[model samples]
Target chain A: MTPQTDRRLQPRRFLLLTLFLAGALLFGLVAGHEWASPARLARAFANSGGHDMTSQLLVVWRLPRVLAAAMVGALLGVGGAIFQGVFRNPLAEPYLLGASGGAAIGATIALLVPLGLPGGPVLAALSFLGAWGATWLVLGAAGLQGRPDTAGLLLAGVAVAAMLGAVRSFLMLALSDDTVNLQVVLSWTLGGVQTPDAGGLAILALLTAGALAVSLPLARGLDLLGLGDDQAFAFGLDPARFERRAVLVGAAVVAAAVAFGGLVAFVGLIAPHIGRWLIGPRHRALLPASALIGAALVAVCDGVARAALPPAEIPLGLVTALIGGPFFLILLMRRLRA
Target chain B: MIAVDCASVSVGRKGTSLLRDISFRLNGAGFVGVLGPNGAGKSTLLRVLAGLRAPDAGEARWNGLATPRWPARKRAAFCGYLPQQFAPAWDYEAGDIIALGAGRASAGDASPGHVLARFGLTALARRRWSMLSGGERARVMLAATLATSPALVLADEPGASLDVRHKLDLLRRLRSASTSSLVVAVMHDLDLALRFCDRILLLEEGALVADCSPDDLLAGDALDRVFGLRLQKVRRHDDHDWVIGLG
Candidate 1:
């Protein structure tokens, strides 16, 4: 639908914008290399029988990073939308609920002690478990009275996150002398989407899909919940039950994203808001729009991370925050005017 | 016709009673105005009647069924409640908000367009709630409540922030709506309540002080005692009764 005639396709516009964004990022990724040129790309595609060094680098290096970035971004974007809708607070995100903190602490401890398993997968597993533990603890604290307490859950998340932060600090100081262990911990926690192998990519894909499956069905409930618990109840919804389900879905998404790309921030928070601003607050359109926007944001950040500095890669989280922060300000200003 | 029976219901919280041993039986169609001083359990009584809150003692029943026994979805179909302090978090269109209430009603509820037209809110159907004036917002909310075509409507402070014209219009619509449904509203304006309500329930410190017609209530000293004021009659016409408060 054309923008002149229809607003129903407002979200479609945002999705199309994301596609264009992805195309630009792919162009940058393929052509940004000093040795790589249009002639090389054309030759690589034209000559199918013999493999060249350029084609090998394209397949082995660039493709994995792009796919991981898109997957992780979709997870974060969807998770952020669920969290904000469930909490009925625009500032709410997966990280705000302590999932990332728990994952970071778990990954740190796993790195310090050799788990006798393959390093990446073991760390990912522990991180996932840590995030799950945090979610349960938060829900338990909120459910002390048999009924789920929204305010209590938020408070509990803050306390748990602070405690986990302290524990992580203590561990870092304890291993200050061992530069190798410290470097591993810092690299894992400080944010970067490492190029994953085929198996790792498959696991990430499964986890993200599972999170989406849980979240999409509850979109209507989330809209009701946004009106507040009492209003939602009056409208024939079980607010506490919906809140529990939404939180679990958000936590699962956060866990999966953190395991793959350590502590990437703002993609979850910014993407949903952008989606809402582009479209309305309806979750049906908001969910997919946010997911696409998130995927594009992260994919572009990864492209810049790799290609901007030649061989010296910038951290994914830094790139996102630096750009997302200014973008958020502009959105806020526009909202105030409207 | 629906029958509401509050069998000695009492609600207390934090060692303070909000409603104490209140009993009432209402049947068929009429407009009921619940009047009370500040913190006199007007909203609490509505909540208890709507089945959102359970009383500490006794029970609220609709027909022969206990309020708590009715499934929420079913209860929502026949019972429309407009809370005292409600502000929608999202800035939805007026028509959309009405549709949300329409969905809470039983299937084949009145269309949002029809309800909005009845409430004189058709012009503002496309306007977002955030852009509406306070009076317009109140009207939109009332439209939403009425769109459900509920058998029983419990509205708290439906005319809280409206001008005199809107307030009178709201009471008139509520009065007419009672021809097909039981309408109970909590009001602070005594004159409006007296002029519009078919019956009045006066509450004082969580106790039912008086339950009668407006004429009977005006003739008694109970209102003076309950309201802590000396109410004086200024004038009375065949269609209107004017009372002035000499505090």
Candidate 2:
């Protein structure tokens, strides 16, 4: 196709994606409110609920939390899509490169140590450092081996994650005999959107936006990479350099999302595959579609988890795994048969 | 001229070398077939020449300048490489796959449609790669590599899965196109290489056993030594020669 034709098609795709995301967001909002209180929800909408505490709660707490869920979910989804596309492996996810394990270990350390520092900010910072550190270590290992073998990198990630998980378990066992502290650690492990303070959320939004901006240009590069390393290099792409940049950008996006919303799984793994099935493997289409679908899935899941039990909410991660695991298995079976 | 000057090039992972003391200068436009047994380092040599892997000992030079030291993108612009068993993970359309070959071309220059048409892939332009048969996919891949219009094309086992007719068509196309470009292929089909290529490089145990024209390289002694083949060349009615294996 001509460049002009590609450009023309972009607007139509953009419009369709926008409409889909808007509809999903609206559904989540209305459903969340209805679930919060079906009777009060009707009355609140009917009477225009003039600047009451209830309205404030909905606007400030509920809205921001839902938006945060969508934003973080989108980042994970898009990051995962890019990862899968570059690696040419459908099973790859944002955490496959050891970011999540590293971040978890970092967060665990922050909790275990009496750092004399503020809790929320310090924990987030440590998590970011850990994620970055793990990625750098993996890259270093790959470089030292002369060739960045994908299988080797994957094995290294699994090894590091196992080591970190053991350390985290040890820390939890040592520090938390009290139920509340234990619950906090457990809840953190079983992911949730933490309803970040406005300042923190704003910073996260900025970082996420910046990462997306940097990554958007790589859509074409990712497409080239999908052709495999030799072909990509033949097409004038410096695979090693491009891979490093992509990994760093992807890790940063994931780290930012994890910092705000702890340890959400499956959205990253599933969204991209679904997007590829729907939109084909064109990164230009797959990236945005995965982002939208991911956001919608998380928003709907979070809403369901929140309202499923009247007073007791399920962890968002558990809900996602419950839904994603069976579906992932089915997809795997189909792929294998094919 | 599409020249490659290699001087004592060696490549390997650790202590053992895959390709050792390889030195050659290819200075003309012609088809050069590299023939070797399974582990004789034919692919490694191609990779080193294509600048995909680093040479441990010596340099691969293009136009008297070292290829590794040259600007990567610039070097890539002049050389196209096709590795063994190249399969796209995602089902990219034939056109999109070919368009990747037009690297660094402004969005305005040579649409993939034009290249696909040239390679008789116009009808299959929108077809997903996964849907195509192995032969068709090979053609599409060849189209992708050719879309670059590089001075040098290094293809490893380019005709592996192609049928008899398509194999001949590809060889003929490569030979006809060699007036302006150098095509280096690692070929398993000795008869096809003997029929199509100008020069043949025979390798055994990571060393060059023979490097000469096809007429000189395919003699009884060289064939027996390099390929362990006891074969007789017989003339066919269509002004072609065929190698018949003798037990």
Candidate 3:
């Protein structure tokens, strides 16, 4: 097909794909339970005055978890796109940058610290600071004379993440005698949607939306930035300033996602690749498309996690990596060949 | 007319000089070629002139205003620079690349299509820059530089990877372009510089050894001293005077 014709059809295909994924997720919300038939749902809705167990189960527990998964996934996806743009490396993601590991460190510190603070906001703030700190450290270690060394940055992030992971393990070990639920902490580390309450999910949605607002306006600059720092400067951007802004915004999104949904792996990396395949590399379209794809990916993955192993719930991170890893390899192989 | 004045510009670290005590003044429209041996700081001098580097000792001024002091947007508006290497992170179309070089003037600026057509790159407008041949990519990059429509253009070895025909065509185009803007190009081809450029600057060991007309450059022994080579000069009545190096 002609490039013009291909371009015209891509948006339509993306729209159809989005609609189909939304339909599937909506169906998934009602499909898993044995008692969740259309008639039973209608009856539960009709008799929804007080103590309707099935309705509460469907509306209260499942709905929020699925939506939370989607929001967190969207956060990760957009963050990945920003990281790729700012760092000019296709392999860049918050998880790889130790943002997730940093968030875990922050959350553990918040829980185990003597501040006696409230749960949600304090945890989020700590996680945000932690994510930002870790990213800055990685950038600093990998930067030479104010310019990022891409390979060094990735390697440094990995080394720092490993160190942070060890710290987290130590924190967990130290807290074992303090009556903290090791199971919960383990699940969070392995990455699972904790089924946040409506208020918590609402706060997550707000934070993610706010981060996206700050980032969407930077789309054009990000596109120019992807051409490397020197090239971006020559093309009329202040590369150092723009890079910091993008990296900070992306870290915020990742921190918020980690605070809410734990360290869901690979969504950020894979979703943008999928989005780039659906649309081109222009950040204006790529960001939103990646978000949509990530939302669907997480929702579907959560649904599978719910239904796949029945009562023994598998963590979302395992499922994402299990699926995203091989798929990414295939895509990478294709790209390398091309 | 654009005036580029460099005053004792020196750049490097650890008390070593990559470009040392370089000074020159140019005004009006003309093509000037910078010639030097390897490690003689041709690229460094070009970067200094393009305002991509800050000299340790002195400054470069454009129209009497220090280049580093000019606001980035203002500097970009008046000066267009093309680096020796083009490593774009994205596979942008040739047209989009040029449009980016046009800056925020997308509303009323010269369309990228027009620029591509001018560079004989209309057919490659939709092609991904990474997929293009070396010569085609060079043309696209030069087209982006031209699209900025600056009063001064700084290019580093633009014709390095091009063939004989394309190199000659590129030099001819730059020669014509110099009628409206000052073009400074770093070149290894002394013959091409002599044929197309009005003036030449020869450097040795990070210092300017000669800054004179192309005829004067050929008439002197600076080339032999700087490059350690002898040149055979052929003067013609057709104004196509050329000089080539012999061992």
Ranking by lDDT: 3, 1, 2
Q: How far is candidate 2 from the true structure (C-alpha RMSD, Å)?
A: 4.0
Candidate 3: stretches off by over 4 Å = A1-10, A30-52, A144-151, A176-182, A328-338, B104-107, B117-122
Clashes counted in candidate 2 amount to: 0
lDDT (Cα, tens digit) per residue for candidate 2, span B13-44: 77777887888889879899998888888988
Predicted candidate 1 versus true structure: per-residue lDDT over B112-212, tens digit per residue: 76788877888988777677987787777777777777889898877777788877877777889899999999989988888888889999999999999
Docking class of 3: medium
lDDT of each: 0.77, 0.75, 0.79
For model 3, the DockQ equals 0.55
Better TM-score candidate (2, 3)? 3
RMSD in angstroms between candidate 1 and the native structure over all alpha carbons: 4.2
> Which model, 1 or 3, shows the larger TM-score?
3
Error of 2 at A198 (Å): 2.9
Error of 2 at A327 (Å): 1.8
Q: Predict model 1's lDDT versus the native.
A: 0.77
Q: What is the lDDT of residue A181 in candidate 1?
A: 79
Candidate 2 per-residue C-alpha lDDT over A74-115 given as tens digits, one digit per residue, 9 for 90 to 100: 888887887676556676565656677667767877877778
Candidate 3, pairs of clashing residues: none
Q: Please report the candidate that would top lDDT against the real structure.
A: 3
The reply for model 1, stretches above 4 Å from the true place, is A1-7, A11-15, A24-28, A31-50, A106-129, A132-160, A171-185, A326-338, B105-123, B234-238
